[model samples]
Target: MHRVLDILATEDGDVSEVVNRFRDIENTALRTAFHNCAVLLRMLEAQAGLTPTWEGGPGAETQQAVASNTKSTDSSPPTKNAPKRRFTPQELQPFVDETQRGKVSVAKVYVDGASRGNPGPAGIGVALFTMDGKKIAQISRAIGTTTNNAAEYTALIEALKLAKDLGIQQLYVLSDSQLMVNQMTGRYKVKHPQIAEFVAQAQELAKQFAKVSFHFIERENNRLADALSTAPIAKIPNQRTDSSSQELMALLDDNPDEGRTE
Candidate 1:
């Protein structure tokens, strides 16, 4: 509602057209807002050199019909105290426009994992960059205390997941973890049982793509991924000081696979 108000206040060539556009909103409180704020919007319109239509403005009859059907007794304006309405798939199409994402079938994924200690607080960062070097999205969050190796594999898993979400087919995964890169590329054997599981999980996700290649990147070149992985550490207290707090902090991000320990 606030965003709509801001848009109405904008000096468009035909501000009334903008006002008429939203009048068809079926949401009671939303439509009510447009009706109650009728005078204010007209004043705004006139202030910008546009003619003000206060009495029986465009869509006034529709607003009157909606207002009479409203069941709420309270006359107070709506507040954003309730959960936001979820958008239907059709409503999401506008956001999928070129401004949000271009035709991106190939992308470079940079992933890095950070841990305060060998088996302390961990976080993973995955940055998706298009072939033209445009960074489209990022994933950054603190994971509960876990080994550095587990976090590295988790980062790769996340990178693949993000790629799949974006419908990316060809992926060039760049990481600063040499051991992880070597293992994923078949240069080194996975001796650690736990890490082997991580490699297995990553391989399964990798199969979803047309091509997924791992490459060793210099730590200097992987600054964005490094920063993303470690960014959560400072936001949460050290595990040694408050393990409970760290656990709570980890809950802030939505994790689909919960209770999966490292």
Candidate 2:
């Protein structure tokens, strides 16, 4: 600690000098200690909401020019890294149109899971509808800390359970998450052990229904479910699950996915 402080105080916070000093240290234990100290300092800086500055070397000018060019292009198409635009809940609806030949008695279920920080406070949302497009039930619940994938699986599981309780025999499951949909349909393998457990649970619940089909939809087609899954109630400390669920259910029921296909 003292050595790092000394280096900062004497070297005017020159990270390069500290880097050089650590590079010169031959003792493995001392080097490890320095590494830990550096990591701690970085974590502290992050906690303080500090914008880290880097001393960009020779390519700094080139990088800046590229950035300026990207910013200057007014009519250019979006880059691969552009932020995705979300659809309003009103815009989401079943992919199948009313004009479709036959409307089976299967219940349509749209499920979504949201995580603020991927592994942060998470929530699951499920919207159910009868074959003729009558909204029947909705379920949303905050599941505390979990990954998006976990929340996605949880949403499906809860939806399956709800369908079972409703005595639903046929279910058409829909999700915006291609990964979750693919995994459920056996198109993709569940590589993670935790995800495998969730999949197994969902499978067991699915057995209650005579037939359950998984389908992948685009984000725009899943607005209602997405909105419920990412609702603000999930972030409240000591939040009431029932209240959150009710709020989400209301939102889902009122904001029926409608309009023309994108």
Candidate 3:
């Protein structure tokens, strides 16, 4: 720590010294490990509202450019209580050293749920990714008859289960279910009894992780997981566990397009 600080404090925080020090780490995997640790440290600091005080810290130029772009685009009158601005990729670049962007251990998961009817056949999907946006693993499974919100929570639960199985400690989850996200974040009340129960289950599962974050993305942005969810339900003959064929599916799946339980 002292050596790193000394390097950063030198020559008005000239990062060339830091680069040179990094180069001294001859082992490639060790270099990536160090870089990943630093990334997590910086995230923890940011969570505590701490910012780098060192002069000429990493990505200062890009950070300024991003900020400038942000200010330039706020020309329109701001709406009242405009939902907290989504943090774009551009805004998060300053935290990562460009050289080590793809090597960081922080991971992300995109999840989605689908139901033909609110209480009709349902499915959950999950797609986990590495820090650099590489898809690592995915899941698409049907979970019988359930409410849409329950399916949403089931998707989250399945994602968490996969992440935990993969030994992931830091996770960022994205879902197209706005109701699920808002309720998980305590922004909305869990009104339905079934949904409330699932919410508790999800929250308890989240506690097993070192960190878990949930965000709401539009359905279009969540195509992969959305497709995964739809697949298990869309193929009725094969996806069904019983000998029930297309005709039985038709009977159970009537008005499957309706009964959207939020």
Candidate 4:
């Protein structure tokens, strides 16, 4: 009934024309269902402060007369707070045209994870870019305490969530964590019970898109996301920090591999 109401709300046709469209259905059961639907529609119209009168010119007058003779007055009115305005067909026609003509665009994403110690202070970073290399968004957040792999999984989850928000149909995920990429792509089995839930969440998010691919890259090629991952550690004042800036600098300067290629 609501679907019929929504259709009628957007169309400019008279009620009789609407009824005739339903009446042409060859199935007796479907015709009976449409008849009941039409009755419910008339009652709804009356409740919306409109008098139920057919407007299909002189031919519809007889149909309206027969309907009026059989109709009852037990119908309830619309609630006082019911919304008044509805979208017209003209307003939504452009959306229909665009849907039929437009093609889905793909988005590329980069993700990196960081931890001060193996299972210590951690942060996750994600970078979103268009197919043409234009950066769309970057996000970095500190997770209280977790392993490097957990942080990596968290970053992938965050990136997928952002892609969903952007309505991206295709995604290419690049990450420096081979373990994360392998596990997400089903090449490696998740052995740790602690990180299993996070991996499951990432897999669920991947299903929301039409297509997604994960790639592993050396840390050198993932510099932007790596820099974002370490930004928070660099912001601490020397006086209040446990470690000096030089030590932090050395940690950032250390390469995951000395002779790795992009």
lDDT string, candidate 2, 85-194, tens digits: 46454533323233322333356778998866555578888877654345567776688876677788899998887777766767778887777777777766665677
**In candidate 4, which residue pairs get closer than 3 Å at backbone N, Cα or C atoms, i.e. clash?**
none
Question: Which of the predicted structures, 1 or 3, would earn the higher lDDT when compared with the native?
Answer: 1
Model 1 TM-score, all chains together? 0.54
Query: 1-262, model 3: which lDDT tens digit per residue?
Result: 3234342454332233454467568878879987998799667645433332221112232343344345443432222113333433332221212343334345677888887755568888777765434456777778987656667788899888877777676677887776677778877665556667888998998998767888775554566677777777876543334435644543433332223444
- Report the candidate with higher lDDT, 1 versus 4: 1
Every model's TM-score: 0.54, 0.51, 0.54, 0.51
Count clashes in each candidate, considering only residues at least 3 apart in sequence or on different chains: 0, 1, 1, 0
Off by more than 4 A, model 1: 1-102, 241-262
Model 4, residue 101: C-alpha shift (Å): 18
Ranking by lDDT: 1, 2, 3, 4
> What count of clashes does model 3 give?
1
Candidate 1 clashing pairs, residues 3+ apart or interchain: none
Model 2 regions lying over 4 Å from their true place: 1-105, 232-262
Point out the worst 10-residue segment of candidate 1 by lDDT.
51-60
Candidate that scores best on lDDT:
1
